[model samples]
Every structure is written in C-alpha cells, then in structure tokens.
Target: MTQKTMSSLQRVLTSLSHKEPDRVPFFLLTTMHGAKELGISIEQYFSQARNVVEGQLRMREKYRHDCYYSFFYAPIEVEAWGGEVLFYDDGPPNSGAPIIRNAENIKHLTPPKIEETPCLLKVLEATRLLKNEVGDDAPIIGVAMSPYSLPVMQMGFDNYIELMLDQPDLFAQLMKVNEAFCIAWSNAQLEAGATAICYFDPVSSTTITPREMYLKTGFNVARQTLAQIKGPTATHMASGRCLPIVEDLANTGTAIIGVSVLEDLAELKSACRGKLTVLGNLNGIEMRRWTLEQAESKVKDAIARAGSGGGFILSDNHGEIPWQVSDEILMAISEAVHKWGKYPLTWLEDHG
Candidate 1:
C-alpha cells in the first residue's frame, strides 16, 4: 500500500511520537542566520517584531526547512535580570559580564518580570506574529534558558561550578528564582502561539561538567522545571556532548533532546529509539566552510544513520547556524535532506 502525503505538522508530530510519516521531519534552526538573510545587522534584525517574523518567512522561502524557530538570542533573557548584552557583527550576542557578583547575590536574586522586559516582550510578540501567520502550517519552537544552565550566565563558568560544588544551598536559591522566571517566560511564549518550548541547557552536558554533577543538579532542576511548563518541551545541550547524560535526560519529561556533533549519531539514535525524539548532530560551527559536496555527504550520512525510524528530526547540532555560513551550502543541505530523507530511505543502498 502507498502512504498518503503528510503536511510538515504531521511529519514532525509523527516523528515525535516515534512513528514513520511519509518523510522525515527536519528544520534548519537558522537563528541569527535569519538576520544575515535580511541583509541587516543582527542588531537591526532583532530590533522589532515584524523584522523577526519577516526574516523567518524569508528564511523558509529560501531554505524550505520545517519548523519555525521563534527565538531571539539567549543572552537577551539575561538582560531581563540587568545583565548587559553585547551584540556583534558575527553570531549572536553574549552577556557582557556575569550578573551575580557573589554568593549572597543568589539569596537576594529575583526572577525578572517578563512583561517589564522589552527585549523579551519583542520576542513574545514575534512568536505571536508567527503563530498568526503560520500557526497551522508547521511547528513553532520557542526557546527558554534552563534554570540549571542559566547559572553559567548568572555567574561565570568557574564561579558557577564552585557554587554548585562547594555551596549547594546558594545554587538552590538561584535555581528557585530562575525556575520561576523560566516557567513564566516559557508560558508566555506558548500562550503567544508556540507549539512547544525548547529548554536550552548547555551547561547540563557532561562535556561541560562531570556526569555526576549533571545528575545531582541539572537533572533535578530539569525534572522540576519541565513539570511546571504548560506545554511539551525539548531539552537542548547546545553543541556539547549529551550521550553520557542522555538516559537521565530521557526521564526529564521532555518530548525530545538536541544531540551534539561530538557524539556518534547512530548510537544516539539507538539510545533514544523509543524514549524521545532526536534533533541533530550537524556541525554548525564548521558549516561556514563546507562545500556543496561536503554538505550533501554529511546530510546523507546523518539521515542514513538516524532517519530509519520516525524518532528523528534533522538540524544543526549547535542549535544556531553561525551568521557566517553561506546561502549555497545551506541550500545544498536542504536539497540533500529532501532527496534522501523520504520514508523507507531505500535509495541509500544503491547510491550511497
């Protein structure tokens, strides 16, 4: 029997449920690259809600990838807490400095009010606009920094590790404040029209810290925060290795988790087989220099490794495409995925 054609929504949903649809669902995850497409500076592209929505629409037109990413730079969230955010000529903005100066600061820390934060409000408005425009067309993914991982921005990496190890109580206090902020911010996006929220937690990866550390702090925070989120969510570890902690991540109530390029894709798929969906392993950092052939080969290999069943969503590993990646390579990747990503993937044996 022949299968019926599926919409992008059906494709992603079927894959999320571990069922093969007509084709494998994939998204480009072109975050700041959208700004690059608009021929505008990152600062200008993110200045207004319409600019982001327009960039997304144009990005889809050019790449034709599934899923609309309704996200702004991550550090913008830190701005809500009074952290200075510095934009750039290339890539996303970075926190100017750690917001927390000392351990006592954690005790006095409070969640930033989302409504009162302008940058956050613009992001929420962008989500609402995208939903109004293509709400039924494809998945709209909203992003939130995980409470456990946000500490890296709250304090410097070294300071956060010290606090996590030497002073558990202070870390807990920080998590409490961040947790409230995360839930409220995430729900606001969902209400604005996000299909699911992406919990970005790079510091939770074992590559960033010991597996034991993740188990103790990141795991519990993820579990608790995920419970409070009103909608389905995905746990993403940026580009860091997640396999050592993938099993623990499975129990965190997330529908999916973004894998990293540093790990083996086949094993990651096998590990996530029935538990949750796998989102990627594409090496975005090096994509700027990839030729058409390299782009095609990598996409083909990734699909062949993880696209057998429906529990896969292909995307760049690090979540955001660097602003430097050119149009030709990205277009080539999309073409390759569409060529080999069809259900059954029987073409692999003859050609690949």
Candidate 2:
C-alpha cells in the first residue's frame, strides 16, 4: 500500500520486520509534551490514564506520526519498589533517595506486584485505554527501564556504580531482583495491549561500565528479561558507549536497537544491517533549539544517513523530547520524514 493508505501500526510493524513500508515510521519518545498542546498541566497529564490517552491522541492527529508511546516518569517502577520519587509540575518525576541503602537493604526488598502499585497500575491502564481508543490505527509502545537502569533508580546512580565495583556478589543478587521485576512488568504491559516493549538502559552504556562489567551485569539481565517478553521489543541506551556492544545487544534478540544522536547512524546501519531495526539519531535538544528550516534539514540528514533500506524508525535519541519544543517544530519533523523518508530511497537518489 502507499504511505497514505497504510495505518500507523502497519507502517511500524513493516519497518520492524526489515521491509519497506510506504514510508519510514516516526516514533515520538514522550507524550507529556502533548499535554501542553491539549491545555493541561504536566501533573494532570500524568495523573489519569484518560489524560495521557487524550494528549497522545492529540499529538498523533496534529503531527500524523506513525507511533504513539505510553511513557510517564521513569521512576514509577522504582517507587513501586519502595524508593522515593519526587514529582514535578512541568517535568518527569525524579528519583529521590536510594531504597537499597546498603548491602543489607537488599534482603528486605521484594518484587513489586503490578496490581498492588498505583503508579505502575496507571501505566497499564493507559495502555489499555489507548488500545481501546486507537485499536489498530497506531502502534502503542510500552516503556520500561533496563535492569541495570532500574537498580540505579532504586539505589542512587553513584551508589549503584560503587556497589558494582566494591561488592560484586551483592550487586549480582540485586540484579536478580531487578531482572525478575523487569520480566513481570514487561509481560504485564504486553498483556495490556502494548504492541512492543521499549527498554531504556542509559546506565549500561560504556560511559558507565566496561564491556566486561556490562556483559556480566547488565547484558545478561537484559537478555533474560527480554526473552520473557512475548511481543516485539526494542532497547535504547543513550550514549555512544553502547557502540562496542552493538552486536551483543542485537544478539539478545530485541527486534530494534536504538541509536543515540552521539553515535554515527552510518556506522550503526552498517553494524545492525540484518540483525536489528535502528531507531533514532535526531537530537531532541537540538530539535528544541533549531528553527523550522534547521529542524527539517536535520530530519532529512537522519533519513539520508539511516533510511537507506528498511529497519529504521525516525525518533529522538534521548528518552523524551523536551516540553518546550514548539508544535510547529514537531510538525515540521513529521512532515519532513514523510516527504524525504519514502521507501526505495533509490527513488530520491535518482530523482535528486
């Protein structure tokens, strides 16, 4: 079918399957910004399942993008595990004090039951709401932090790193707990109607740990968690540090591997050729700062760099697009992708 004739869900699935859809699918990282367009506060945006559905639907209608993700603050899982989380009126909630204060604290921890936690329950509710409203019109992505990232959420980031190096055995035990929670949480989202589960692992990047350390700690846990997820899965690590382990990450069997703006898309496309679908490279920070012309130029550049065949999704390299980026800029990005990211990119090369 032509790009105009295909539904968003169809376009995303086709691209994930390494086939050319009518066009390259556009996937937004956050729906919180959509709240502002709908004339609601960030607090209200995250408070109700219906509000999130409304905000995301508004953005999809306005931008005509191919995918909608149900992402709230990253700390909900942490909060469910008894960690403190600080909320904000205009931004995502922040991780507060570490729950796993020391080695002994791990003994007291228990895997959170999804149904018992209001914070996590809301996300599941939002997924169901979106599925009911959008049906097959668009792909609804469920979001979760990576196993390594989850520990950093419950324990402070610096503390978790220290634990990794200072107390290896203790850290492994903690990872087991995190891994179990990730599996259960991911499965629940899949059952709730998310077409795919996207895991963010900013901590496992080489910037945070060596390849050997990551393989022992983060990589294995991720593989175990992902193996249990019943639907298509994607992973995002927000640094070039992940480059060294690209092949390893792909081997974990996730269908999509996210590429940050810091990494060269050309390199990723080459490395992930047949193994993983590549999603990202647009710098959300730059998108927020650039004018319409500049933003469109960047989108066109990303497509030229990574949109050669299929197995690509246009997206921001980071977790979420900043709330301050104007709707005009967001629309410009969607329009540019549709205009320049058509499949059979050979057509553009020959015509241009």
Candidate 3:
C-alpha cells in the first residue's frame, strides 16, 4: 500500500471540497471514550480543560481517527441558560430541570454571555488547547445546538412540542434568544480554531416534526442561526431520517449533513451528490454488541454505498460513540475504514 499523505484536516477538507483525497476521514465521536482512556469518570474528565484535551489527544494517537471532538456533554449548553446538568457513568449528561417553565418566560429571556457560563468556558478552553497542540494535523469539531432544538433542554420535550404547536409566536421568541447564543458560542469556537461547527438540530427532523412545521419554525431558525456563524458547518439531525428534507438540508449553507441509519446510504449520497458531504449511519445503540468481523463489514458496506466519491466521513448514526461500545469494536471500525476507504475506490466501482 502507498504511504498515507494528507493530514487529517487536509483529508477532511479535500473530501468536503468534493474531491477524493488520500482516503476517507473518520470521526469516531468518542466523547465518553476519552474519559475512559484517562481512567476517570465522564463527569470528572469534563471538569477540567486539561483533562479533556489530554484524553482527546490520547484517543487520536491510539485510534488514528481524523477529528478532535472538542465537545462536552449535550446539556452544558443548557447549563448556560441556568439548567442543572446531571452526569452519568454510562452516557452523556442530562438536565435536572427545565429552565423555562412558562410561555411568557420565553419572551423575556436573554441569551447568556460566555464569560458568565462556567462549563461552556471549560469547553472553549479545551478547544483552544487542541488548536494550539494539534490543529495543524486534525480537524477540531465544535458543536452548537440549533435554536429550534435547544428547547428540548431549555424546557422539556413534551412542553416544547406543545408550545411549538400551540403558541408559535412564543416558540419564535425562544428561537430568537437561542439564535443569539448559538451564533455567539459557535463563532467563539471558530475564533478559538475549530474547523467547523456541527449544527445539531435533532427536533427539526421529519421523524419528530412535520414538513410544514419545520419549514415554518425549525427551518427558518436554522437558516438564520447557521448563516451567522463564522466558519464552515455541518447540519446533523442526530439519528432522525433526513431523506425527506435532504434538499432542504443542503440549502442551509452547510458543507455536510449527518444522515440516519434509516436512510439508504447510496440514496443519500445520490441526493446530495455534488452539494454536501455525508457523514454517518452506523447504529450506535446496536454497535455495542458488534463483533470485529461485523464492525469491519459495516465499514466496508458504508464505504461501498457512500465512499465512491470524496464526500464521506465514517461515523455513528447518532453523532456519538455510546459508552457501551467496546474499545476493540471501535478499533475494528477504524482499521476497516483504513482498509476500504482509500480514494479512487476501484474495488467499489468494479464490484458495487
């Protein structure tokens, strides 16, 4: 085999530019795995920027993955709005209570300043450390929850759904506040040297909301929020099906879209062929039980389906590596990508 040539950042950028690079880049999205590497609990690992950065560096060194996940638990963003975060031994953190209770509260809320938020500051610091140490070699991915989706934590999901349907104006008000925070926070990461922001907008998916509802609320809010961010971006709807709105997703000025396992990878690749890079489809929940051979087969299949061109990043459907996934399985997936994801995938053209 030929010696690999591109840095992970260059590899990813080349793919994003819609051309084959040396190989397909992979982002394992190993949030908790980093904590596991340090022999510490996820909660303690997240408490310090140095610990998070050290763990991320170690993970990349061991796995040969392409990205630095300069991210914290999902609810840290909610913490900025005064929500309490309760961490777990097996997964990401969750909110203790909904910060916004009444519809009227939405109208009066002010977006929190970065300096005023402790956990968010730690995340940014971790990003800065990654940039200083390894930004030249790999892409540092930052995440910003979409204004339309932050309500899943700002208030409870059921409450958000009721408000979204019953009081559209109040929903719009909440979006305005979230929009400001999302833009500011995302731009801050870019300023700190993140390659792109992952615009995580799960509730906007067709599985969760109707087409008309998204176009009216989530779509418009995402467009506005994504437009104002300072750097490149990827719009991800977590594990929700995106095929119905694939074109709509492509139109959001994002360079990539994270697709669900529910969508056919080939169809998704065809749908956004020239317009966007495609990332993910492996089922994180099911992956915990995957054998080495099964993991390799999944990688080969994903590459056969979507790796023909230059716009693919191998990853999980939900944008996170579940803690239950064994280290051996993750290593197998990485090794498989390196085996089958080389550019000008002649094997696929011949056999697929």
Candidate 4:
C-alpha cells in the first residue's frame, strides 16, 4: 500500500486522531518570537489586527511549522473583563492588576461579549485573515486561557489560591462565569476561522492548586467548556508538576493535550496512547540557551521518547516560545524532527 503525503492540516488532524502522518507535526507556542522575527516591537506586533496577522504569517513561513497558533497573551479575556495589562516593546503583554479583589466581587462580575472587547476582537480579526490567506494549507489555532487560569487572572494568583481553600463556593461561581466567557470567545474565533481552540490552563497543576481542588473546579469547568466547542479542542497544561492530573485532563475530551517538559513524556504518552494526541515536552528555556548541537540532542531525545507509532507532536513545553530562541534554534528543531521522527517501531528497537 502507498502511504499518503499530508498537508499541515491533514498532518495535525491525523495525529490528533491518534494516527501517524508522513512525519511528526511541529508546534510552537509562539508569541514574542514571531514579533522579533518580523523586525517589529512586541507592542507593534500586537497593536493591530494587520500586525498580528503579518507577524504570525512571517513566523509560520520561516519555520514552516505544521501548526500556526494565534496567541497574544494570557490576559486577553482578563483585559476584556476590566483588568489592566502591561504591554512591553520586546515581550508579550503581562497582566497588570486584579479586577476582582475579593470573593464578594464575584457576584457583580459579568462575562464580556467577545465582539465588544477590543483585544479579543483583534484576535478574531487576525484569525479570519489567517484563514483567508492560508486557506486549508495549515491548521490555525485560536488560543484562550482556560477556566483555571481565568480566575487567577481576575483575582491575583495568591488571592485565587486562598479562595480555592477559604471560599470554594465563590471560586466555583467565578469559574462558571469564566467558563461561559471562554466558550464565547473560543466560538467566536472558530467562527472567524480557527480550526481548533488551544485552551491554556497553567494554574491547574498540582504545584499551584491542590489536585482535589483542581478536579472539582478546573477539571469540571474544562470538561464543560470543551463540550460546548464545535471543532477540535486542545488543552495546554503549562505547569511542571502536571503528571498527577494527566488522566483528568484527558477526561475533558480534548483532541490534543499540550504536555510540558516538566512532565515525563513517555509516561504521558503511555497514559494518552490511542486516546488523544500529546504535543510537547521540550524545555523552551533550555532550547533557547542550548547550542545547535545541544538543541538537536534534546529534540532527538524527545522524539525517541514520545514520537512512536502516532499521536505525538514535536513542540516547546512552555506557553510562549521565549524571544531568546533564535531562528537557527527553531529551524534546527524542525530539521531534527524531520530527520529523526519517522513512523514504525524499528528505530526505537535499534536505539533502545
């Protein structure tokens, strides 16, 4: 039988379906890196829809990555909900202050309509442009912070942690509002042209929220939100100690789960095998600091660990690809994946 050659979309979708494509797909959690490559300040890159589209296009063209993710920062929804954001010329935006300081404020809070919010509207606009320009050539993912992180953004992380224990009922109510907002924002992006929603939930890890609390609030809300989305959905768990909740994350029914280098890729692959595509485990910080030889070694190691059978994507473990990562490093990662990541169980036996 003749094997099929897959486009970027087909390759990603194929892997998401827990099957192999011609080669392993590459995903970058890019933000500032794209702006840097475009020779523009991060502020300029995210200031308008056109700049966002151009930056993403240039980055995708340069990397020729299998997936292009449209993400500005984690605080888009928070900014929409009246939180302040500190924009930097050289880096991605950062959340400035908490909008909801106490649990009592939760009752008065309301979800922002995506169309009425400036930053979110820009994101949707960029998604539309990318879809029109790229057509069906590659998969364009629209990103939003998951319910776990949303509450953290609204109230500061420290306050949120306290609420999880002191005011569980209030936290649960806030999560419901955040979940509704995430669903609306994600659906708008999907309607605008994103093929999938990559929901980022870094605060749900055992390191921050207790496993039991997360399962009750974060996990439940994530499952509900994923169910409402029409297209494929991916959950990006950015915390280091994410191993404990791997099964809970998979239970949310996301088509893909973004694993960080902090977790054991082999263990995650074992847990998620034939269930959902696992996309990651590369340390973005280490990748940025390593030489070409070092980077290639790590890339090959990741492939050897998780790039078996099908259902694995080569990617950076963190949320945003750091600006320190040069184009050479990024390209080296792609080259190494193409060279070492091939289907079938023969290579593992040879190396092992």
lDDT by residue for model 3 (1-352), tens: 5646899989999888888889888998988888899999999998999999999999999899999998887888988888899989988888888998877898789999997788888988999999999958998999999888889998899999999889978887888888999999999999888889999989988889888878888888878888899899998879998888887887778889998998899999999888989999899999999999999999999989988778888889988889999999999999999888887687886764
Per-prediction count of colliding residue pairs? 0, 0, 0, 0
Candidates in order, TM-scores: namely 0.97, 0.95, 0.97, 0.95
TM-score of 1: 0.97
* Residue 120 Cα positional deviation in candidate 2, in Å, after optimal superposition: 1.0
Task: Please state the error at residue 66 of candidate 2 in Å.
Answer: 1.3
lDDT of 4 by residue, 1-352 (tens): 3356779888887777777777788886687776776677887778888877887888888777887677778777778998898987656688887899768999878899877788888888888998999999998888878877877778887888888789878877888888888888888889999998998887876766788878777788889999998888888877446677777877988877788777788998988898878888788877768898887888888888888778998888876787778889988887887777656535678788
Decoy 2 TM-score against native: 0.95
Per residue, candidate 1 scores C-alpha lDDT tens digits across 32-59 of: 8777777889989888999899999999
lDDT of each: 0.89, 0.81, 0.89, 0.81
Q: Per-candidate RMSD vs. true structure?
A: 1.3, 1.8, 1.3, 1.7
Off by more than 4 A, model 1? none
Encode model 2's per-residue lDDT on 1-352: one tens digit a residue.
Answer: 2445578888888887778888888987766686787687777778898888888888888888887788877777877887777867666778898777777787667799988999899999989998998898898888888877877778777888888889888787887877888888888998988988888887777777788987887888888888987888888876445678888898787888777887788788888887888989788877778898998899888888788768899898885887767788988888898788777676557645
lDDT of residue 252 for candidate 2: 83
Q: What is candidate 4's CA lDDT for residue 162?
A: 87
